[model samples]
Target: MTPSDASPWNSPGTVRQLGKMLFDHNPTLKINPSVIPSIVGWGLRFLANSTYERHKANMISNIRIARLSLEALRSIRQTAHLNYDQTTRGTMRVFPRGGRMTEFVQMCREMKQWGVQFEVLDQNQILEKEPCLGAVIDRYVGAVFFPDDESGDAHKFTNEIARLATELGVQLLLNTNILKIVNGSSSRISHLSTSRGDVSADVYVLSLGSYSPILARPLGISLPIIPVKGYSVTVALNGWKGGPTRPVMDDGYHAMMVPMGDRLRMGGRAEFAGYDTRVDEEEGWRVLDDIMKILPVLRSHIDANAVLNWSGLRAMTPGGPPLVGPTSYANLLLNTGHGPLGWTMACGSAKLISDLITHRQV
Candidate 1:
């Protein structure tokens, strides 16, 4: 969300059998004892229902939503007059191993069919886009550049939106904790039982990130969402001119380094620790190490002791796309379960939910 919050808007492993195929890539993934049975049960259901056709359909839906959301973000930035270290140089995904480029090429071709604009760049082209990466250019075979993609301080954008909404006569409720959702007699949300008091709304939108399922369960809605924890570390450039100018996704380590204004934010690692938002300093350092492995020039410029470590939970669903739109309860709509792409797809998802609520054709 911001440098302060662990949410990436600004911005998983199995047993031995599942590990190599799925989990091994994420060494940080760990399941809480309470969620083990649930995880296993959901895993079985996922495997059983998963099909190549189904996966393709989901991917297509997610990609469309993401592309639309990018445009929405641009509009919001203009509306809010936001310029919090916003980078429009586009984003890049570097494939350290040459073999990975082949798979990416195939994916790019398929994406191109959907009108997604991307350029497949060799090592030299990648360096040209971000000269700070020259130190590790040899380590990369090629990269896929998404020209439409952008990066910025999600926290600042969120706050600006909130401020704008308030100016539009929207009431701002702060420090009020929602204890539960009170159901009405006729398949709808009657009101919310909050820590402050009981508040009623004609319609309610359940956009409570990872905690959405907790309240929905009492209402007989079986939300297949899990809280996946992720880690991030932000380091000041400290006059280091060699840091990346834009966002870079490292394929080898499954991480991202985003230049947020003068600060460089590097975050990655999916740990299924379930609601534990504890920051592991060592893990943060490990992320730095992973980044340094690719950009060795930053080694001398960064001070390890000054890095800020943060952790946040993501609401992930079995299917990649978020569970948006109306639920069984007519007045209660869903806008959660976005996982790691919450910030990227926020505006599009919000627009979709609003259109649905207003009975507008989407």
Candidate 2:
């Protein structure tokens, strides 16, 4: 069925937990709320039968989030006139009417309290919005897209955010890993000794991403942060026939094509090979082939083609959603594990983390 009629519980991640619940509680009947997700989901769904509406609301919100994020980047870049962009966070118009293969696994996505529709954009309508994508618009039967999907420069964005945080008197620390945790109990963390030095505060945050667990365990807390390694290739946008545009991701293989300034960020594959953050050809070019396959006009030699290619690690949790709640420790809160949406979720996540630390509810 179309996303319009699809249920949020239709997602595999929630269903897997559901299946586990069905088995864990009893093979025959039902169990308890322990296996279920948030209470709001169960109560609103089971009691009132409002899940479908909620799912549609959430899908629309995703579109708005994608849109707002793209606008933020575009506004920032435009204001600065800096030449930088990325596919992971930006205005990405997926046009099936232009022969572009658009597919992505939306299997385990959570429906937000807000609205964001997952309805496929019509092929004809998308091209009208993005004329430059006319060539690759015809291939897809339908599109599950974030129209405002833009390519983001995380390094640039982080640098900017750090500047803002500094302005807000939020101490910005980088490469300063917390080597040890001193205390945790009654929702309070006492001290954090980083590689640089010991830091004692009324509140401490763990934005350590994938390395969160190593430190969390010592404090009698378990953080479900897993390193999800992904590979990205940056190809130059100069001398390319096709007009540079926003980012694209192949739903079939997690392959993404994102245009940033004068370069294209092609990403593909997610390897669960422990903590190794090495970049190799086989893993890096999984999406490259797809790029050449889809957008042939931009094809060229590896040397002349790409200015830089690299891989980055994303901290993923068991469920795709980020871990953004306070721990048992009042001072220690979790803010990592954003996966692909880290850049998009950064501002919101940081605000939420900030709220948690300050005891703000909304």
Candidate 3:
């Protein structure tokens, strides 16, 4: 995990971008009419809670948490011996504009103080590291390489972990839709009304990503989380020798491209639309177009029509840090609102929650 926040929702340029997204007809960031009221309410609360001092404190805490997450994932990878198409080739953050490179240099100095390891690379060094980017080298001013950062398949990791958990006596319930959380006479959650049946638990942990707020609202728990939609397009590399060997984050377009086995997955854009999970083909094309600009060589090797488009909602909090640990209900705990860093922070978040539940040192 990187020490700096690169999310479009929480970056330094968020305020200016938010203004455009709210007012202008920005293609990348859309605000549906129905979500405006909710957005306004959340915006007011966000402003009230997000003071400069508070944000600084949260950033420091989150940096520590992110470090721990990276360590935890490494430990799991080594100890479990589970292969999820993991790679340690690191990630490169390329800056197209000189101004963005300056901002990143400032961030690098700040992160260095926190013990985050990174190397600043010039155009020559960046091209040397990944020669596939040579075609678009002129488009970049500079780059930052986080050698400790990693890339992997989240779906593979989850399946492997689930299999291991089942061997450890944890029951698996598939295709069970949680209708609602039902509470008994006491203050805690009694059982969950589900598609299969009502299931009771001694302690309940809410980890339903973007949909957590929807379920928590019935319990008077106003989680300050909004579902921010994002898109991804995966294209088969077709044995393309010019494809990037590692992950690359394009600072200019707020997009990222990662090599996943035989496929190259690129994701970007943040939409403020409410709960709509529909995959827009136009949006997919736009994301593909943006990523192609960063790696123009992909045009000849891969067929544009063979790409897979996906869309998902990320649970974002007003403040960057996720809502973890206990809630008002003693038996209920929260482990959501991770935004774009959900996969990066998942193992550490799970560890923290487990320690909390076990009453161990966290």
Best by lDDT: 3
Off by over 4 Å in 2: 1-10, 13-114, 117-138, 168-170, 184-187, 239-241, 301-307, 360-362
- Candidate 3 residue runs with Cα over 4 Å from true position: 1-8, 20-26, 47-52, 360-362
TM-score per model over all chains: 0.90, 0.69, 0.93
Considering lDDT, which of the candidate structures 2 and 3 is the better prediction for this target?
Answer: 3
Task: Give the candidate order by descending TM-score.
Answer: 3, 1, 2
Greater TM-score among 1 and 3 belongs to 3
Error of 2 at 223 (Å): 1.8
**After superposition on all CA atoms, how large is the RMSD of candidate 2?**
9.2
Residue-level lDDT of model 1, residues 96-175, one tens digit each, is 86545675566567666665668889888988898888877888889988776778877777887888888899997889
Please provide, for model 2 over 1-362, each residue's C-alpha lDDT reduced to its tens digit, 9 standing for 90 to 100.
Answer: 01121232223234434454346421211333443342234233322322445444434533343345445555555655443344432233343343323323242134222233344566665555445456666654555554333446677666775675577797766778778988845556678888899888776777778788888887788766666567777876655536445555444333566666656777655555456677777545555766666665565434543446677767855434567777776567788776556776665566567666677521
Candidate no. 1 TM-score: 0.90
Candidate 1's displacement at residue 70, Å, is 1.7
TM-score of 2: 0.69
Worst 10 residues of 2 by lDDT: 1-10
Model 3, CA-based lDDT: 0.80
Model 3 weakest 10-residue run by lDDT: 3-12
lDDT of 3 at 322: 85
Q: TM-score of model 3 relative to the true fold? A: 0.93
Best by TM-score: 3
